[model samples]
Structures are given as structure tokens and as C-alpha cells.
Target: MSKLKVQWADQHEFHALLRRSEVEDKPVLLDLHSPECSGCVNHDRNIYSDPDIARDVMEYTFPVRVVTTDPDRASTDIINNHIYIWSPTIQLLAPDQTRHHEWNGAPRRTRLSVGYQTVFHDTPGHLTPDAFKAQFLVARGKAALRNKKYGKAIGLFDEAITRHPDDRVTVEEVSRWRKVAQDGGVIESTWDHQHQVTTSPLAAAVERFAQTVATLPDNVLMQDWIGKPGTGDWQWYSDCLREVVLQAYQELCNFAVTAERERARHGPRFNDTHRLLGQHRFAYREFQSLFIGVPDALLDQTPLRSERSIRENLAHMVMAEWWAYRPQILHALDRGRKGLPPQVVPATDTVAQHGEPPGSHESLHELLALYERLHLRNTQDFSGITDNELGIRSAWWELGPVELRFRLERYIWHPRDHAVSIDKILDASGHRHTANHRFAARLFSGLETAEAALIGTDGFLAGRVDSLMTTINERADEAARLLSQVTDIKPGIG
Candidate 1:
């Protein structure tokens, strides 16, 4: 057999292999276990896993692993090789192949196996050039960080520092990671720059702050900071941090889902849609401040439509606004007198629809044809109607007190509120956050042009008042006119 250098630990395999080697008349380096060894843990998982060490010790020393439980098995061979014994020991066989030399535990170091019944771990000893032991600690620390176990990562990194006292890398690594532990780190780069995300560390911190703002008696310290002011002072920063961002996000998700399902049955124009529709209704008022120019900012005038088409669509929006309040206005006229409203109320009485995009029909041709019919019918009907019809009012309020028309108008403000939100969403998405915040600009333009034509035809507003259905039909015609001019390019869009 060729000569080999050997390092060894353990007592179990040591006994087994040595006995076999002796019988085969081969050199056998039997590892011994004195009740006193200290650094064996380092050797097994780390050293044996290395290639150079595996090569040199291959042929000559039939290295056997051992523990105190089975010494006799290799005990015979151990004694035969003239192998020197030491507990938890490592020995090398001499080249003449019959003699042995031993390495006992270093001075003052205790045996590694003494009081540990846990997994046999090789406690690291100072490693030379390769940074073997310290490198393992570094890797372990990184893994801990990934699990969000900051405390564990810090400990591992600290231990690495102890092992490599002079390596500057240890200091830099720790400093960098400490920031992440405190502030938390999240991955955030534009994926070649398109979509935007705001729900990780940055947003988490914000949510945590928000929790503090929604405080209770339990938040004594936060309450104290705010004094008697309803905690307004604390809101500045406390409104943004998130202790557990994902948990809060799940709650919001649940709330949104529940609300959406309920809203679906309520018809379209729930909030923002309702508000924008109101602006359209107010579009024709001589008092421009009540409506027009409200959506100047946050608009994208880059669509394919021209100035006139926008006004016509906006005019239709006003008609929709009038129709939206029809049910409530009519109901106050009757006072829930009818048994109850039908379950699936048709769109004529509803403010919005959930199914299909606006203007959808079985075929594009069918839809276009319907628009054509409305255009022809609307002008003819408006021309034939008399001024007496204009002065007539449908049932909306009762004699007891408030009229349904005014009360419904009051709630119409709710829709207007949503118009603001919709505008913000649009502006933010389009990278135009600086405009006048006008969400109604495009519709306003369209409404103006549309109203001029409809009101100018034969009868004006004072002389053109008609039934809600007649109004809607006329509005639909206006919608068709504006839509036809839309040119496949919608401008002032979000």
C-alpha cells in the first residue's frame, strides 16, 4: 500500500476498519478516543468534505471511525500496529508500515465529546489560509437573513467576527447588514421600467405607522405623545409604518373583495362613476364653476378625438346624471309605496351596469346601427315635444316635506367625491401627476359641443324638458355622435 497522511476523529468506524486492516496485513491507523479531545467537530463535516485531505490518506491508513462503545473491534488491530493510544485521537502509520505516531488534543484543550449528546458537531479550530471555518459562519449568517431571522443572522455574523478578528471584511459585512435588520430591506428596481409596486419594506413601514395612528387605549405612549389633540400630531409619521405588512394587506384585500361583490349588484356609477356623471348633468349650467374645467389636470388630451366630440360625450354624461337619480326622485314621489323594487332592476332605472363594456352589442355593426337609430329618433322627438311638456315634473317628492329631487341631488355629491379619486388614479398611472387635477376635462369638452346641438334644435332647455326616457334617448344619440368621432383614440385619459 502507498503511504498516506492521516487525521482522524470518532471511535466507532475506527474500531471496525482497523480490525479488518490488521487481518489483511495492511497498515492501519486506528483513531482512539481518550476521555479528552476538543476539536473533532471541525474535522468531520469540514475536513473530510475537502478533496486534498481525502486523497493523501486513501491507501496507507485504513482510517476507521470510532466512538467509545466499540473499541474491541478495532482494539486488536490498534495494539498490533504499535499504534499509540489517546482518547478522541488521530494517529498516522509510519511508512515502514508497522509503526504509528499520534496527535493528542492540543494543550489545555478538552475532549470534544465530553458533555455533548447532541449531534456530533466539530467545533471549529483556527483554520489556516483558506478561511474555511469563518467562511462557513458567513454562509450560515446569510441563510439566516433570508429566513427573516435577523437575530440569528446577527449572532452568526458576530461569531464570524470572533474567528477572523483582523479581517476587515467582517466589519464591513456586519455594518451593512445591521442597517437591513433595523430598516428592513426589500428588492425594488424597475423591471426595465413599466409597472410600479408599493407594498414591500417602504410600504410596510408606512402601514406600521398607520396602525399607530389608528390607536386605542393600549397605545399609552403614542397617546401621551399626541396629548389632547385627537392624536393629530402623531399622524404625520405614525400613519406609515407596518409591523406586519402582509397581515394588514390581507385584511384590506378581504374588505375590498366583500365590498366589490355588494357593489356589483348596485349597478355601475357606484362612486366615482356616479360623481363624474353628476358633473356631466351640471355641465349645461350657465354657472361654469359648478362643473366645466373641473377635470383640467390629470387629463391626457393625446387621444384621437377632437374638441367637439369630447363636449358631446360630456353632454351625454349630464343626461346620465339626471337618469341616475331618477329612481330615488321617483321613489320620494311614491314613498316605497310599491311593494318593493324588482330584484333585477333594468338599466333604465339603474345608475349603472356591471356587465359588458359600454357600447357593446352582439356585433359592432349592431351597436353602430343602434346609435344611428337613436340619432335620427332623438332630434325628431325633441322637435315635436311642446313647451308644456318641458314645464312638467315627474313624481319625486311628497307634500309632507322635502322633495325627492333636491334630496337626491344632495347625495349626488357622493359621486363627485369618487370623481376626484378616479382622477388621481388616472393622473398617477399616466405619469402626469402635475396637471390641474381635473378628471372631467375631456367629458366637459364633449358635453359642451353636444349640448349646443341638442338644446339648439327647435326647443331650448326652458322649452325642452321631457320624460326621463326621452331625455336618455336624446343623450344616447349625443353619446353616439361623440363616440363616432372618437377615432379609436381616447384623449385626456388616465
Candidate 2:
């Protein structure tokens, strides 16, 4: 048997090497990865195991392995949290653990194509020692800029820039990233900012929706939302159901957050979140179609307490979402009281039982009053959530300790998903809604795929609540403002 030849850096020695790189202005190869990562496993199997790569690795820099596991607790922690969202992340640290150039998960081509210089993600193939040295010099040079060693670092970086002279990686991209590192004394690639912004996944849909519906008068159906019975083949309507475009996304984030609260939730770390936004886009598309020319017949549809009014449907959506989490909320409430409210609060209205109607029956004030109660219920339940619930196995179900947060979020999003359809039906008759069904289906399918991609990973959701919640509040204001603008127009009772 050929004697096994393995080069390993001891823990203390590894740290020392990293520290030296920082002080001495040297570059080091620091691989921060986990054994369990599928991506990491692939990289190891395909690249690290290569004999040529092993031989060549020695020439570039010190190769150290930092094991990021928690055997003592058998659970995830802060650093693990980082790994969960940003798996197999490669960082060029200044021996001192100061990050220099990091390969973000950005689609290199898409990132570079944008106007601003972006630190594009690089999937570096395991290279021979010589090649490794070349890249290391460049990466290390970038890390060295913090100590006012611009010229020295430039030499390394410039070589790298030359090696890939015809490559798409731009000078602006490298310069901008270098500046970020210098300012912070350790560079966190701009890719992090992009990921953070794209975290919600739903925000993109909302932004697009806002752009689509910015000029609607009263209702898209040209009727007052307060009076119509809310109905339209929403499933067959636009791809994005307006209410759920963001609401569903909010639910998705909340679900991931609540399910993994004890852990961290990376904002839709996968593509599933993006797909959800894509479905939402269809809903906005339908909204745009209804008001493009403001059909005279549809203008009469008022917000009066009608079965079909969007206001009622949105209000109902609020309650539906509230009801979904009611059991858990009540369970929390009952923990302190001798007796608690009922878990399931189904609506008794005949119209509600068969799904809300399309005509008006209640005043806006009365409907809002109902919505207020639902909102109150939702907030109370969330605020009362506990660490025990977050950290331990849930007792909410028997099949398995299911993630309660994800379930609760489904309810939040379901209404919004359907809301898009209802809004379309309100704006036009069955005609527009029917014509757009196929498009909606295609988009909805895209959303499901996106949700699965994003939600399937170890990414977290709780982290995105603030921005998402802010958007909902803003949409509510916008919707309210649209109604006010229409109050002055003569009611076109068709």
C-alpha cells in the first residue's frame, strides 16, 4: 500500500498562519467549510482530492481546515447560522481573519452585466500549485489594501487582472470591492448586500405590482371594493394574486422564521422565493390590464359593502391568515389562563361559508373593524411566541414536530395568492380573468418552483420580517389612498 500523504494545518498553527498573513502582508488559503455541505462535499471530491491539486496547493499558501461543527450541543449556533445561509463560502483573509476577496454566489455574468461594478461570484476550480499561487497572490493583494499597501497589493491584483485579461471580471468590480474592504478594514463582498436586498424575494414582486397598479381609480373592476362580492377565477386569473404576492411572501418568511427561530433564517436563500415573486408578477399583470383604459362599465364598481369588492376580500384575507395561526396563538394564550378561546373561528355568514360574495352589504368602517380584530389576533399570537417553541420540537402536530411558522405563513400567503385573482375579476368581468388563466398558471408554476428552491435550503426567514412588514404597511396605505381619490368621482352605478 502506498503510504498516505496528507498535508494538514493544526488548529493553532492554522490560526497563526492566518494571523501572520495579516501582519506580514502575506496571502493565505483559508477554506471555511463544513463536512456535511453537499456543495462542499462536491468541491472536496472533485477538486481537493485531485493529486495534482494537492501537490500544487502547497506552492500557493498554507492550507488550513477550520471544522465548523458543534458536537457539544448537537444543534446550530451563530457561526453555523452563517454557514447555513452561505455554504461553502471561500474567503481570502489577511492571516488575521480579515476577509479580503470572497466569492459570492452571484451569477457572474448577470452581476457584471449590471451598470454598477459588482463583486461577481467565482466558482474557482481547484487548480495546480502554480495556478493556485497566481490566484492567491491576486486575492491576497486585494486583502492587503487595508494597511495602505496599495501598490504592493496592486501588483498581485494586477497580475490576476492580466491572467484573465479578456475575462468579464471588470476593474470597476475589483476596485469597488477593494474599497469596501478598505473602508471596513475587512471586505464583505457587495454580493452580501445584493443577497440581503433580494432576501425577501417578494419585494421584487411588490415593486413590480406597485408599478403596475400605481394609477388605478377606486377598483380595477371600476367598482367600489366595499360593496361587491369578491369573486373571479383567481386561480385562472393573473399569475400573482395581489394580496398574497407580498402577503404570501411575508407568510413564507414568517414560516421559515417561526419554524427555525431557534436557528437563523436567511432571507429565502434559494430560488423558491424568487419563483414566488414571479407568480406575484402575474397578479400585477392582471391588475394592470383592468385599468389600462378604465372601461366605462367597470367604473361603477364601488367599494361599498359589496360581496366582490377588493376591500372585503383583502379584509377577509387578513382574517383567513389570522385563523390559520389561531390554534397556536390560543395555545400560547391558554398557557397562562385556566380557560382559553376556541382554536377554530370559522365565519358563519352564508356568503363566507361559500366564499365571500360579489356585492356590497357593509360600510367600510364596519369591514375595517373586523379587519382590525384579525390584525390584533395575528400580532398577539406572534408576540407571545416562545424560545421553547423555537428551539425544541413542536407539539403542534403528531405526524412529526412540523414547523408551525411555515404553516402559519401559508395562511398569510394563501389569501394574497387568491387576492390577485379577485382583484382581476373586480376590474374586469369573466372575460379578462378567463383570457389570462393560462398565463397565470404558467406564472404560478414558476412561483411554486421558486418557493421550493428558496425554502428547501438551510436558509432562514425571521431575518426578513422588518422589511416585509414595512412593505405591507406601505401597500395598505396605497390601497387606502386609491379609494380616497375615487370618492370624488360620481358613482358610476352600472
Clashes of each: 60, 70
Q: CA lDDT of 56 in candidate 1?
A: 37
Which stretches of candidate 2 lie above 4 Å from their native place? 1-6, 33-60, 67-84, 104-137, 166-172, 175-494
lDDT of each: 0.34, 0.39
Model 2 over residues 1-494: C-alpha lDDT tens digits? 75222265644565578666656555555555455544455556655666655655555456665544322221122123223112224445454343444433211110112221122222222233343334444565655555567666666666666765543333433454344444543332211101111123453343223322332332343333332122243233223234323343444344444544433453423233233333433332333223222222232233322123343354444434443245443453454243332232222222123332221223333333344455434443454344333322223323344343444445346645655646665645533433222222333333333333333333344345454445444543454454356554332211
By lDDT, the best candidate is: 2
lDDT of 2 at 123: 28
Candidate that would win on TM-score: 2
